[model samples]
Target: MHSGLPNGEHALIVHQAGDLSNSCANVGPIMAPDKKFNVSAIFGNIKVDGTKNATIDREIDWPKDISLIGRSLVIHKLSVMEWSLRNKDILPLACGTIGFASP
Candidate 1:
């Protein structure tokens, strides 16, 4: 993903709902199907280079039972490390709903 965000590591997460009606606030909580709050829902951090672009080349491992389709992927203003340490609410910078790619 590319953004005008300051060059730094940011948090990426998958929320339970695909709703973006209220910005990123109404996306509901992280997609923790098994009630495991600390696991699958968090996609860790994405480092934004000087060009303000971030990429994840590797495949992310997620719970097989949980389908990411129709879910919301959110990019947070702070890195997961910073957010966890500071214990602050997630500040979403951008978001998009997950969907299938075209053939």
Candidate 2:
């Protein structure tokens, strides 16, 4: 992901809703269909280089039941650990809806 974000590790999560009408805040909470938080909801962290670019060359092991088709991929301002420890405020830096490419 090429972003204007600062060089640091940022949190990546998939929200329940795909809505971006009111910015990332409208994306809703991390996708917890079971009404419980788990490893599935965490997409891990994206390390931004000095050039503000992040690359994930490996395939992510996603849960089969959770469909990310219409969900939103949110890039938080802080890393997962920082956000969890400091404050629960998930300040989003960027957001995009997950979808398949057209043929």
Candidate 3:
């Protein structure tokens, strides 16, 4: 997927959103059936500019045991504003889902 975040550091995390709960609610740093964001499913971090098109081509190393076929890939906002008075929640900028490639 191409980079949608502004010129800064951002991470792509896989959230379990194809079940009873929503993806944003079940957040985590590891892969699980009911967990939110899976760190193990992270493609990686990327730097992008909001003004220009900085397309990112990510390669997925699928887990043989975990089925993230319909999971959500969420882009998180990470910056130096953590020390500020703003809310410390890791806000999700965007979301995408894993799907089968058409022939």
lDDT leader: 1
Better of 2 and 3 by TM-score: 2
User: Which pairs clash in model 1?
Assistant: none
> How many steric clashes does model 3 contain?
5
TM-score of each: 0.78, 0.79, 0.57
| Candidate 2 residue lDDT tens string, 47-90 | 88877678542357765666789999988888878866776455
Better of 1 and 2 by TM-score: 2
Off by over 4 Å in 1: 35-39, 86-90
Worst 10 residues of 1 by lDDT: 32-41
Judge candidate 1 at residue 73 and give its lDDT.
Answer: 96
Name the runs in model 2 displaced over 4 angstroms: 33-39, 56-59
lDDT: worst 10-residue window of model 2: 33-42
Model 3: lDDT of residue 81: 35
How accurate locally is residue 9 in candidate 2, as Cα lDDT from 0 to 100? 82
- The segments of candidate 3 whose C-alpha lies over 4 angstroms from its true place after superposition are 2-4, 19-30, 33-39, 55-59, 79-88
Instruction: Give the per-residue lDDT of model 1 (tens digit) for 4-79.
Output: 8777888788888999876678788877767753346778888888877776534677767668899999888888
Better of 1 and 3 by TM-score: 1
